[model samples]
Target chain A: MAGHSAGTEIERLIQLLSRLPGLGPRSARRAALQLLGKKETLMRPLADALQDAADHVLTCTTCGNLDTTDPCSICADGRRDKGVICVVEQVADLWALERAGANSGQYHVLGGTLSALDGVGPDDLNISGLVTRVSGSDVREVVLALNATVDGQATAHYITDQLEGSGANVSQVAHGVPVGGELDYLDDGTLAAAMKARRPF
Target chain B: MAGHSAGTEIERLIQLLSRLPGLGPRSARRAALQLLGKKETLMRPLADALQDAADHVLTCTTCGNLDTTDPCSICADGRRDKGVICVVEQVADLWALERAGANSGQYHVLGGTLSALDGVGPDDLNISGLVTRVSGSDVREVVLALNATVDGQATAHYITDQLEGSGANVSQVAHGVPVGGELDYLDDGTLAAAMKARRPF
Candidate 1:
């Protein structure tokens, strides 16, 4: 009689799942069902991966990004150009640019941008570390890929100001407006061409 | 001049992020970037919540739903009918049934169906527990709300077989196919009407 206690296992899964972003009690429950339905493929592996990551992953010492090791693979890569650094607000932006196959330069993750109203300051970002990175003798250009929002712009300015004495040529992603981004949701060609036609701010 | 070190944080984030469901390296980076752009609101809370949930949550014992408590709110509800158990393959199905707002009976999560190719057996499904639940007194009807997939059907039959001698009537959700679920993507009115005219399996 106690053998049919499916609810007990499910309860454990639901609790872990409900905590995911965009999932409330309802969606979390639904997701749990979906995961349970594919127990062999989805459930156990997900649990294992989560636990593994939680246990093994650590923030890169050189950068603020998450990593299983300290220096991170990219930072340890000697083949990459240490001279030019692409500054981005989040780690995702660096991947996007890489996917575009546009820039081969090294990268700096700012972690997040400067926001005055919400009380985020310079220390919260990776500004100081970035400034130190720019000081290395071989470094050259610094491309800024921060978003175009108010906070994004402010963060951009803060980075530019910090890089003043470093002598690195700073730039932002060109192409007026983004494709698939509102202005709204433009064509790739338009975005690409805009990047090609960017002017100084 | 050293300030920004590109590829440090971004690469680490991608490695960590690529592990999420529906996200490869590309999408994870995109999500991380989006979070960076909205750090104060979306980013911080998301991180805090994830950490909090990871640290605090445990599985519920009674209904198989996730909660901070063992029984979960639904299982603890004495007002719900213990006699009529609505069986579903996942937590999602249970939530969907709840969303439909008609069924007020207690729930039993199957966790998954019997899939031979995937090496899933009855012991894997938490089904044996359902048999025990039915044998207990006061049980009346058991509603099966499985999907219309081949595996779903096979699981339903298996469940019906288990309940054969339990003296309880068993039924499946009837009416239109799901709206977003597509036959393909039916209208709300059609879906609502389908529930009204659901037939016996």
Candidate 2:
């Protein structure tokens, strides 16, 4: 259905808005009209904010985290333990980890995991940047905090191969029943892994 | 669990984005990060589009539909039946009707229905403009095509009361079971209304 007869400008806004991750064509129009309805309070500020973010935000040189600075706030912060680097698949994953207060160490955002099906090789990710950071630093440990997907495992194995001679020890996050998870809903693979890694009470 | 440490610009974008319909805190962050990651292809274009719309689009004094011109394209179109005006609650509803090719008549956007709880009354809507249009022209019918909600019906009734002596006929959209809808899922009120309004089909 042609739901785009408002005007060229509004239609254009809707088209662009639909490209946003969580928005579809229908919700985009709703958002566009809402913005137009509250032009001074919403539309103008959103436009300005988008432009400002586009211009200021940059990828960190040390880590792959996104911020308004070159090295990013986390990388530049002296309080974080630079000797223990926590690796993540994406900047969002890094943010999730940080929000959980999971680690006091610095982060290394991989940008993406390797996937042969998608033709995303090691070069496509921030692997070289990660290797360089680990090689130069006095890193005691390099934590591989990747997801449990096949691509994540493949990428982790590749990274381990790349850092074979590096001084830092590599370790992956433990797999088990989640903190609030029910035993009845536990999958076979998780049950086996958690059982294997069981410690004495 | 503060998940907004990307920087002020990203944080601000997330805050603004969350305000849009169909978006919440988590989804807004995902959208903001997506925009940042594709600045040239997505972010820049969206920013430009929003600015262009804000600068060019204006509310049509003739009908209340937002457009780049004083008289909206729909209202200015000579092909449409100006004698028959379809009155709707909002510009979005007008667009929906136009897309469906439901009516070839002109439209008058009321902006909203009367909501006594929220203090919305006839004066809050574009009722006087509608009255003036009906009075001045040889308009055969003024279709009160508002939604089927309590407020919508109340507003329609109020407008009918206001246009008592006007020459033009006043009518509302038909209320019945929606096409392709199941009988089991139909509400009692709608079923009764549809049965009452049943015609020789």
Candidate 3:
């Protein structure tokens, strides 16, 4: 309770910061203290920028990526190869693929995977929009870059079935252990997945 | 460049987030992405809290600890033993001591330790204010909870000298390896501190 105060807004800020992944109450307290130390240098600009982003960052109508414009940079660029569209779960994943210097064509953000337990389905996703884009356009291939979770695979299969006989090749990207999340902490399900996808199999 | 965007506001927020201790570009990106994903759930409350903290939280008049009121909670609490004041460089250090449940007295926040290289001196610190508090009150002891840095030791000495003729007993906290900072990464000074303060000398 480093920065905790009765009805103090800094306390609330610390609470919110603590809720973030990888940030505990101690980390949140340190962060809040740092902000207080340099209010002009850090806090003011942060607040203004957050407000600006909240007010202005409208998601791209077609791709669902956060953008100032309606179509996003990838969708608007005429020079980019439009025949192939890469479908990703989140805009951050799309950006990661771009950072890797691969996939220069286009993107379709699925919003999230189809988690039946979470009540997430194809209709709940941006898949219907993706289907529309694939069926109405001269697209040659749809690359599925979804994660390798059971829900992710189910979503991929569902999308593939939707694209069947639509004159567009449907292929799912490989599923494997993440470069981050620790292998030791992985449960039995992921261990089985790793074993099945082992090399030379 | 994980979260960098064309917008000046977006770039500024990402830059500020990245500058936080223990938060590099990767962590900052992950945090920003999380914020974007749950904008309404996280951002609104966070923004309001930040604004309110920035506008209201002020430095304590007595101890330099940040607080909504002038004297801060410790200084304000009448039940707290004011005869023994625990002096610490940062409010974080004060909170750490509080978490350990060792000291039950009041606290005095120094803001930072004396550093000649950084042009910080006793005058720059809350030293004179501390001396004033000691002089005016019936305080019997002032415990130094400063970090075991070179500057920390120097500031402790300086404070000891100031309280020498004031009838207040001054004591420095014991030194040891940090709770988290690895031994391999510790500087020579910290290593010497750990060795010199070894048990059973």
> Which CAPRI quality tier does the interface of model 1 achieve?
incorrect
Error of 3 at B140 (Å): 1.9
Candidate scoring better on lDDT of 2 and 3: 2
Compare candidates 2 and 3 on DockQ and give the better one. 2
Ranking by DockQ: 2, 3, 1
Backbone clash pairs in model 2 (N, Cα, C under 3 Å; residues 3+ apart or in different chains), count? 0
Please state the CAPRI-style docking class of candidate 3. acceptable
Report the TM-score of chain B alone for all candidates: 0.79, 0.96, 0.82
- Backbone Cα, N, C clashes tallied per candidate: 39, 0, 0
* DockQ of each model vs. true complex: 0.12, 0.71, 0.36
Model 2 bad stretches (over 4 Å): A1-4, B1-4
The best candidate by lDDT is 2
CA-based DockQ, model 2: 0.71
Compare the candidates by TM-score and give the number of the best one: 2
Candidate 2 lDDT by residue in tens digits, A1-201: 225447888888998999888899889988988999999999999999999999999998888888899889888888889899999998888888888889899999898899999999999998998899888679989999999889999999999999988889999999888999998898998898899999898
Tens-digit per-residue lDDT, B123-145, candidate 2: 99999999999886889999999
Candidate 3 Cα lDDT to native: 0.80
